[model samples]
Target: MLTAPIERMLFGLSDDHVIVEPHSGQLMHPEALVAFQRLSADARDAGFDPQVVSGFRNFDRQRTIWNRKARGERPLLDSSGEPLDTGALSDREIVYAILRWSALPGGSRHHWGTDFDVVDRAAMSDNYQPQLTPQEVCDEGIFGPFHCWLDKRIAAGESYGLFRPYAEDRGGIAPERWHLSYAPAARELQDFLTAARLRDLVHKSDLALGETVCEDMDAIFERFVRVPERCYPQENT
Candidate 1:
């Protein structure tokens, strides 16, 4: 297994790399939080409003989401957003189904506090439901303008060092248009994490799907955690 200190930071179990900056509903990384503030301010000036919906989730929180989906408490979906019948699946199949939309507990970037989900405040009411579907980020959806503005910022080098990790369907996970990652820190963490370390850590855990995750560590690391280095911003590349 990897060293404890490194593992702690990687899994977001320690606060060594982050500060408790209030954002959305939880604390966030100081650096990422500053960047997000600037970006949000810019967006507001342009007649758009972006609000964080999630940030800095810990291991237990991730486990709850994972366990719920694995046990069919939450709806699992295919790449096309069709409901999956978890009752018909083996434990292994259920693990994969959950991974299609959720990350293994320790492997989620939310642990690092440098990643978060956002919504356009202009498009939502007090009763607005959060489906977080890709269709909702399309040109016709309420958040369409927000994402379009983000794209233009990325293309013009105006984004405050944020980018999408799952910008497309990569076969291992679904496309989550709402998720934004701080490139500088996220890239460093992503590069340092290895399949061996991730597998070893997860295999040693008591999670219900631990064995299933370790069963194909290579593919999971490749598809879920490690994107092509080139896909990241210049610093990561």
Candidate 2:
């Protein structure tokens, strides 16, 4: 394994001007920063002026979200305030749901500060709800214009090095159609963020679990978490 010191992976926010929120962790990587700026600009051009609803998050924030979900303090879809029956779910199921709702902290691509959740800014003030569904954006009618703008900007010829890591295949993760990855450091960051490490972290955390949690965790890792990094290749060419 081409091991890099874990400490070397540590980085901080690039700018103080950007609005930082509880779950919106520090912004990292110049390419991603530019990509986001362009995304915001493109949204404005499309007459939406979408803002980043969520971004980089740490393990603590992730845990808080997960705990809230378990306590039925939030909704499964939007901010519905209905907690999920975590006791009925296996560890793997819980982890999978958690990933769909929030990343596993250290295992999150956002932790690298390269992935962001872009949302319609106007819709947020209405009720702090998501403006578009996953299907709505995937279709070429609702969020298609924004998608087209993002696609054009992230093409191989773009200087920003932004690429859609989860655009095509669902890959078991949530179909975050708006999420984008900055390739320059994304591959290394992905390698550093692995399923094994994430599982270990979950085991060490205060996650509530049912009787089948361990087995569910084993299955989840085998099925989704342990998949090889074929999509994210090494930083070559």
Candidate 3:
């Protein structure tokens, strides 16, 4: 429930442009970088050197990904188009897809440089199915080493002031088993990144579409982004 002090800035660069390069290992907050290094070392000790697959992105990058999914170029949804694909999606369809796999740039915890997405390097490929479930990946056992490492880190992270925002919240956003946040800054960034501000930025920027795009985006924000802030108290306390 901590409040981030800095104003949200747009950092949504394309997946290809992420500083992580071919591996998508982009910029991370110093603390998170340290934690990741520790996590990586631990994973290696456990017989796996998990690599970071994705990290900080800018709005432009997020938009690119969203657009690709909308065009059916990227498998943002499932085969039946159920949860992941969601059927003949328009740009509006891209909204949920973006939320499910990517964030709206500034809205993403990675943009603040405090979050990262870890994946097994050996299994990941250019032909990788973006919508594949973690369980599916784990079935290969390649992800096991990292999972075991995460179990230990999750227990010790709080002491280092790191926490998982998307942890144990399967009902809302898909649980990103690999996504971890540096809690001290992330708690505040969560509040600072609001649906209203994000919408305004998107509109003012090049990501803005036609009238339909605006309306659809408005709806998407209400449904997916405008949750109660950490400072909100039940019944106003």
Query: Quick one: best TM-score, which candidate?
Result: 1
Q: Where's the lowest-lDDT run of ten residues in candidate 1? A: 228-237
Best by lDDT: 1
Which wins on lDDT, candidate 1 or candidate 3? 1
Off by over 4 Å in 2: 1-26, 38-50, 75-95, 120-132, 140-142, 169-171, 210-237
In model 2, residue pairs whose N, Cα or C atoms come closer than 3 Å (at least 3 residues apart or on different chains), thus clashing, are 72-83
lDDT of 3 at 143: 65
Worst window of 10 by summed lDDT in candidate 3: 228-237
Report the lDDT tens digits of candidate 1 across residue range 153-174: 8767678788888887778788
Per-candidate Cα RMSD to the true structure, in Å, reads: 2.2, 5.8, 6.6
TM-score of 1: 0.91
Task: List TM-scores for all candidates, in order.
Answer: 0.91, 0.65, 0.67
lDDT per residue as tens, model 3, 41-80: 6566656756665666556666676556555666675422
The per-candidate count of clashes, in order, stands at: 0, 1, 17
